[model samples]
Target: MKFVDEASIKVEAGDGGNGCVSFRRERAIPFGGPDGGDGGDGGSVFAVADPNLNTLADFRFTRVFRAQRGDNGSGANCRGASGHDVDIPMPLGSMLFDIATSEKIGELTRSGQRIKIAQGGFHGLGNVRFKSSTNRAPRRASPGSPGEQRELRVELSLMADVGLLGLPNAGKSTLLAAVSAARPKIADYPFTTLYPQPGVVAVGPFKSFVMVDVPGLIEGAAEGAGLGIRFLKHLSRTRLLLHLVDLMPPDQAPLAQQIRTIQDELRAFSSEVAQREQWLVFNKCDLIPADEIEAVVAAVLGDLDWHGRHFVISAVTRAGCEALCAQAMRWIESQAPRSEQDLMDDEISAAAAAAPDAEAGDEDHRPA
Candidate 1:
């Protein structure tokens, strides 16, 4: 999948069938009335949410969508066949906006959800309908009305319970692989993960939540210094953010400033993202000497002025990963279920919203 999140398309409804005009003729009848048939109704156009889809990249290939046209009516009081309704399949979290009116017309968050994009044209009338008391013989029939047509813009935002945030090579991929079945690319280089990868982390039997791993952030990322601008929107839908910090950074990196760099970027990008509930997680503890681990942790905390919830884990060894995931599951269980309306509030990505960022993250990272 190319992972395209936005697309635009044109849709048109089917046209109605035309009416028939004819008069009944019989050898035995002295006078016969009109017996024209009515025309069939046109088909409407609709957009449906499909659970199997995850991106709007497919929309790039086909843009125009038209419904089936109705069959024309015939004489002898025969009605024409109605047009078939056209239904388009799209991924969940995708929203449709009207181009001309700039209106938020429809949003598809749940599977099997459908919304009408255009209405089919009305069927035409027949000459029999024009017969009146004053005018005994009618020779006129109405034409079918044209179907509705319009252009629309579609935007997709992936929804998740938890979002992982950190600098590049922050062990995001390793942690996701440890906690779930997702297999993200793991390398020692920065910017190894280019996009967001989601996985289901099971806390217990039948208890789990979706976790999205976004690309790493570097200094000045909010200013488009790195790939952060492209993927920052992925965090907006998350209820909680897990900030992973590398304990044993290469070249003896500054522990305190490492956390602050990510923080600064997030705040600069969006206030909502900066203000979210973020839990500081010290990663790669296995790399630190067992004897000096306590002192190093204490020093890192002092540098960060840490007072909030914190955790120490090693993704490579799977140490403390289970406990961390368990706690996350419990936290999600305690919080209220998020409403679909919340997804519309984020403006982090190309789409504007009131929530956090718009579309992406890979928090399981920062190389050891």
Candidate 2:
């Protein structure tokens, strides 16, 4: 199925059945009384989070949803049956918003979670309800109340252990294919992957984490350039971000400059996401001269002033993958119990100890 993460729809609750104004007629009875029954309440509309659903494609073609209407009341004092409630299934991590008011209705963060969006109409009264002492006989009956309706927007954010981010053709998809079973489309050109593709990477027999390959980002992405920030929201739920940078970009832009571009976009998109644990993975190392690999990694590291963990790997040759996977697994495991600030502090300490004399930025170059 084509992946659809966002959708807009209209939801309406069912209207209540109309009331009846009938009178009872009995044999051998001198006088008969009102015997009309009340109408049944209408069904409500609800949204449920389903773990099995990964996309919002169901709402793509269908934009309107309505519950069943209640049955009308009958004579002889018989109340009609209530309509069955309707449950709209949506993917986990879906957020609902009111389109008219721009207010957040609620969020479905877990499977089986449900929220009511529209309320059912009230049951109407019958003539029997009006037969009081003041009036020996009454013929008036109340009509059913109308149901509620709403226009809603649903947005989905993927949940992943790691999110891959970089410029176009930066080898994110290649790395994902090398590490996991996901076979996302790949090409020699930029923007080969347009959507977010998630795969499970196994570092141990029973240990693994989910990795999401996000589409490439260019400058002005946060302000609606290129594919825009629509796809960026998918990375909001990631535990960590893996920034893949090509060792040598064909554009000939300084590798540091490319890294800076992506970092700036992340910061512009969301500060909270920008602050997530991010690791630099200098990809396509095989393309670099074998003798210059260490020098290039060190130079890029110096330029980035990177404090977090990093890796150098060739996704095509699968070189350095095992080590990268192992280290990532270890880091993921170790950080499960630590706070975000602690992790940052530890990374800073490591960077300071590793390159005590290396100044990341100076008068000659700007911050990467």
**Model 1 agreement with the true structure over 1-368: per-residue lDDT tens digits:** 76787789999999998888888888997678887877888999999999999988888899999998887778888888989999999988887999999999888878899999899989888888888998666887787788999999887777999999998778988999999999998876655577689999988889999999988899988998867477787787788999998887775778888999999998888899889888988889898787887788789888778888899999999999999999898888879766667655543433544222423233334344
Q: Which stretches of candidate 2 lie over 4 Å from their true place?
A: 334-368
Give the lDDT of residue 210 in candidate 1: 95
TM per candidate comes to 0.79, 0.85
Candidate 2 lDDT tens digits, 1-368? 76788999999998888788988888987578888898989999999999999999989889999988878888999987887789999988899999999999899987899899999988888889888888757888887888889999999888888899999998999999999999999876666577789999998889999899988999999999999998899889898888998988888999888999998999999999999988889889888788998898888889889888889899999998888878778878887888899889999999988673455435337554
Clash count, predicted structure 2: 0
Where in model 1 is the C-alpha error above 4 Å? Answer: 28-31, 219-225, 248-261, 264-274, 290-307, 336-368
Top TM-score hit: 2
| Model 2 RMSD in angstroms | 11.2
Model 1 vs. true fold: TM: 0.79
